[model samples]
Structure formats: structure tokens, C-alpha cells
Target chain A: MKTLLMTISRDLKVAYRNPADVINPLVFFVIVISLFPLGISPSADVLVGIAPGVIWVAALLSCLLSFELMFRSDYEDGSLEQMTFGSGPFILVIMGKIVSHWIMTGLPLALLSPLLGMMLFVPPPGLTALMLSLLLATPTLSLLGSVGAGLTVGLRKGGVLVAILVLPLFVPVLILATAMVQTGIQGGDYTGHMLWLGALLAIATGISPLATSAAVRISLSH
Target chain B: MLNVRNLTCIRDERVLFENLSFSLGAGEALRVEGSNGTGKTTLLRILAGLYEDYEGEVDWALDEFPLYVGHKPGVKDLLTATENLTWLSALQEGQVAPDAVRAALAQVNLRGFEDVSCGSMSEGQRKRVNLARLYLTRASAWILDEPFSAIDVSGIAALEERMNDHVLAGGLLLLITHQQLQLDCAVRSLRLGV
Candidate 1:
């Protein structure tokens, strides 16, 4: 527990030291969502109908944009190698890093969802649903993204490969999140949607750390 | 004791090394030497448990985890030198006080540069910051990959003294380096590619 906390705090310190790292994804989220109104349709009705899917997809892409850097610095500077042979289990340190990274990037993106939803003309009732779905769903993306990041940490051009490897895995959460917000916008029961998103989050929390650890070890082989 | 038998590593349709074996007991140092692309670093990494796609066995008997210092400094660019050492060393053993980090930096001759970010430091300085961990731990075994490379003449000499002291103090040293060192202990050499 001490080791995990130390790792989490250390990662937080590192993330904070470079404010751009924490802010880049948020900027991407805003810019991408902002562009939707410019490029697609400015009609509030069309925007309202597509708001949930647009916001969720934009969040997913912004999260993906930040995934490559998640472990790239550690892998480059050899910190990952040290942690692998360190006393604490490598999986736990990875989990700690992921959680702290989410706190930096995912949490804020979720918090900003309401304003982005309002810009998209989403109903006021769906604002809470958007925030809640993003809160539960982005961490799942981070968890799933870690596996792709770890697998490609050693590759020369890992950015595109990470998206290819991880975006397919993100479809279920995107669907469930959009479904919940759409249902909320329609004044229908969305309890089942939250339950499904919760189930996905639970499973991702359970398996991703282990998969990421194994992927990191395997990356050293190539 | 650290023992290996018939280790073989093949990377991308090319055999880096095969049919290799060696052993190290307490109070000993093993120097891995080879030409470029001959698997010296690969062997050291195998010893350090960083890479594990080989067909062999690594049997180590130690009280705690071993230390591995690789080619890169492992210091975060956004973190100050002191912060990098204090935190990275914590992953190995908990409760790494700030004083220990300072002491380790001093041992590596990096006293005044503690607060500076690693991104701005020179290559040799960054390497020194990484080497400070050697002063921070009491681990039984050390696996260093090219510990002497990218270091200055005096830095190399100081590191030799540290290696001698570690082995003399009964700690095992498994390292890869092209620059030979003068040590006051039994030093074993393994030359890959025959």
C-alpha cells in the first residue's frame, strides 16, 4: 500500500510539473467538440440529437491522444525497467500510475462535460447524465488504453498503433455511455445503462493492470 | 548465488546469443564483454529480470530484490534531480528519505545540482543522478548495463571504487561494460560470440 501510494504521488508530481501534459487532452476535448458545431450542423435540434455520441467520441479520441505518452517517458528513461525489478509488484505500480493519470486527465475531462454538453445543445437533464457517464467511462478508457500503451511503448511510431489496438476495445463503453445520455435526454429509464457501464468498469479495473504489466515485459523482447 | 544454464535469445530471425551459462556467488563481479550486437546488454537484462523471452533458467538466492541500472538514466525530465532519485529509489525500497537522496547524490559527485530539472542537465550529469541509487541501497545483487559508458574519466574511476567496495563488502555485481576496470576482488569475464 505504501509503495502504491508513493508511486501515485510521484506520478502526480511528475504530471503537475509539466502542466501541458495534464492540459493537452482537455484542450483536445474542447477543440474537437467545438469543431463539431463549425463543421457539422449548427442547428440545436440536430446537435441535441447527436450530442451524447459526439461528446463521448470526442472524449475517447482525446483520451487516445494522450495514451502513447502514458508510459513512453518511463520506458524511454528506463524507470519502467527499475520498477519491474523493484520490490513492489509491477502491476500495482502501473495501477497507481493509471489512477493518478486519470485524476490528471480523465477527471477534469469528465468535469468539463457539462459545459461541452451545453454547447452541443444537450438537454439540461442530460447534463448530469453526460457528466456521470464520462466519470465512469473515461477511467475505463484509461484502463483499456494502458494495455495498448504498454504494448507499443517500445515501438518507434506507437501513436497510431495504440489507437488501432485500443479503439476497438472502447466501443462498448462509448455505446453504453451514449445510450445512457440519450435515454436521459428522452426522459426514459437509464438505470440499465449505468449498470452496464459499471460492469465494464469493474472488469477493466480487474484485468487491465495485469495485462499492462505483461505487455511491458513482452515489449522489452522486441 | 546466481546461476544460469543454456540461455539463448533470438530477436527477429536473428540469434543474438545462444548456449550461454554462468554463475556468480557472493563477493564476486562478472564482467560481460562482447562486440557490438553480441548480446552483452541482453545477458545483463536477463539477469535483471527485465527481459524474459529466452530458453534458460535464472536462479537467484538473495534477501531482497536486485538493482538494475540500464543504458538510460531513468530520470524524469519534468522532475528535479533530487525528486527523481528519491522517488525512483522508493520503488525498490520504501522510506527513502530526502537525506538519503542527498547523500547518494553527493556520493555520485552531484551535490549542488539536486534541485535542477533533469531535462536541462547534460548526459553525464543525468547519468550521475541515476548512479546515485548505487549509494542508496544495500541490495545483495547489482545488474548494471554499461555503467561506465557516457561517464567521464574521474567518474569512471569513482565508479570502479564503488564496485570494488560493493564486491568487497560481499555483494554480487553483474555488469556489462567495454571499459575494463581494476578491482581488488575476483572478477570473472564472459565474452559472447566466442
Candidate 2:
């Protein structure tokens, strides 16, 4: 646990030191949300109807953009190799990375979703639930995206390939996340959606890191 | 403290090397000399436990883990030298003291540059920062691929001194270097043919 915390803290420090990396994804999120307003009618009803999908998609893409840098930079610089040889299990190291990525990308997206949600004319009651759903959902995206990022870490053009590999896996997440928001919007009890989201988070937290570590080992091989 | 028996490495439908066997104990080093196309780095990777595709068994009795420094320095370009070292230390063991990082950097002649971002440093300077880990960690085995390539004369001499000290202190060193490396300790040479 100590090692995990230290790794996460270090990653956070690195992410913080480079403000542009953090700002770029946030900008992407805002820009993507703005496009929907221009592309569709400005009617509050239509915008509110589609806001859930738009926010989820933007969040997914933003997470994907940051995922590639997670292990690729470490792998290229030999830090990943050292971690593999270190006393800690490689999976644990990957988990720490996933968690740090969530704190860096997912947490911010969740916090910013409320403002974006307001812009999309989502009902005030639904806005809180939308933020909650994003809070639970984006971390799962980071974890799942990590597996794809690890698999493609060493490839020359792995950026878009990572998106291609991960988006299919994200379909279920997209379905459940938007459903949760849509449920809240429709004045339905969101407990079931929240429960399902929690289950997905649990499954992702349990399985993704181990799979990512294995994929990373394979990718690092010449 | 290290033993390998009949190591065979095959990649891309071609046998890079076959039936290779060697061992290194305390006070000894292995210099894997080979032609350009030969798999010196690949062999080093297999020995370092990073690549398991090769057919071989590497047995080590050392308490501490082996440190593998590849061609790339592996320092994050965006991170300062101190930050990189601290993070690497945490990943390997736990939190390392600031003094230890400072001492290691000074050993590699990077005293004042510890706060500088690695991206702005010269290639040789960056290599020195990477090599500083050897001084910081108590790893018993060091597997370095081409440690001297692209380094200046002073850097090479400093690295050779560190390698000698490591061997003298009962640590093992395995290096792949084309440049002539002069050391006080006995070195076992394994030359590969194209």
C-alpha cells in the first residue's frame, strides 16, 4: 500500500508539473461539448435529450487521449522495466497508474461535468446524478483504457490504435452511463443504474490492471 | 551469483542466437561483444528477466534485484532529475531520502542539475542521471546494454569506476559495450558472430 501510494503521488507530481497535459484534455472536453450545441438545434429539449450521450462520449475520448501517455512514456524511458523487476508486483504498479490516471483525468471530468451539464440544459435534478454517474464511470474507462494502452505502448503509431482497440470495449460503459443519466432525467429511481455502475467499476478495478501488466510485458518484448 | 544454461533466443522466425551459456559471480563481469545484427541487447534483455520468449533458465542467488538500464536513459523528459529518481526509488523499494538522491547525482557529476528537467539535458548528461541509480540502489546485479555508447571520455571513465566498485563490493555487472572498457577487475568476454 505504501509503494502504491508513493507511485501514485509521484505520477500526480509529474502530471501537475506539466500543466498543459492536464489543460489539453479539459479543453478537448469543453470543445467537444461545444460542438454538439452548434451541430444540433439550440432547443433546450433536444439539447437536454442528447446531453448525456455527448458528455459520456467526450469523457471517453478525453480519457483515451491521456491513456496512451500512461505507460508509453514509462516504457520508453525504462521506468516500466525497472518496475517489472522491482519488489512490488507489476500489476500493483499498473493499478497505481490507473488510479493516478483517474485522479488526473476522470476526477476532473466528473467535477466539470456539472457545469457542462448546465450548459446542455440538463434538468437541475438530473445534473447531480449525471455528475455522480460520471464520477463512477470515468474511472472504469481509465482502467479499461489502460489495458489497450499497455498492449499498444511500444508501437510507433499507437495513439489512434489505442482508441480503436478501446472504444469497442467502452460500448457497455457508454450504454450503462447514459442510461443512468437518462433514468435520473426521466424521474425514475437511479439506484439500479448506480448499482450496475458500481459493479462495472468493481470488475474493471479487479481485472484491468492484471491484464494490462501482461500486455505491457508482451509489448516490451522485442 | 548468476547462472545461465543453454540460452536460445529466437525472434521474427530467425534464430538470433542459439545454445548460448555463461555465468557471472561476485568480482566478475560479462561483456557481451557482438556484431551489429547480433542479439547482444536481446540476450541482455532475456537475462534481465524482461524478455521470457527465449529458451533459458537464469538462476540468481543475490538478495537484491538486478537493475537493467537499456539504451534509453528512461528518465521522463518532463520531470526534474530529482523527481525522476524519487519516483523510481519508490517504485523499486519505497521512499528514498533526498540526500541519497543528491549523493548519487553528485557521484555522476550531476550535482546542480538535479532540479533541471531531463528533456533539456544533453544525451551524455541524461545517461549520467540514469546511471546515478546504480549508486542509489543496493541492487546486487547490474545488466547494462551499451553503457558507454554516445558518452564522452569523462563519462565513460566515471562509469568504469562505478562498475569496478560494484564488482569489488561483491555485486555482479553484465555490460554490452563496443568501446574498449578498462577495469581493475576480471571480465568474462562472450563474443557473438554474425
Best by TM-score: 1
Q: lDDT by residue for model 2 over B1-194, one digit each (tens)?
A: 88888888888888988887777888788898889878888888888777889887788887767888898787888888888877776566555898999998898888899899998999888888888888877788899998787788987898898899999988888999989889999898998765
Q: Report the C-alpha lDDT of model 2 over A1-222, residue by residue, as the tens digit.
A: 876787788788878888787788989999999989899988899999999999999999988889888887788777777788767777778888889989989999999999999999998778988999999888899989999999999898999999999999899889998998998888788898889999999999899988998999998885
Q: Give the distance in Å from residue A172's predicted Cα in candidate 1 to where it truly belongs.
A: 1.2
Model 1: CAPRI class: medium
Report fnat, model 1: 0.84
TM-score (0 to 1) of chain B for each candidate: 0.96, 0.94
True contacts kept of 2: 0.78
lDDT (tens digit, per residue) of candidate 1 on B85-144: 988788787769888899999888888999999999999999999888898887889988
Candidate 2 ranges beyond 4 A from true positions: none
Fnat of every candidate, listed in order? 0.84, 0.78
Cα deviation of A152, candidate 2, in Å: 0.6
lDDT scores of the candidates, listed in order: 0.88, 0.86
Candidate 1 global Cα RMSD = 1.5
Clashing pairs in 2: A77-B74, B1-B25
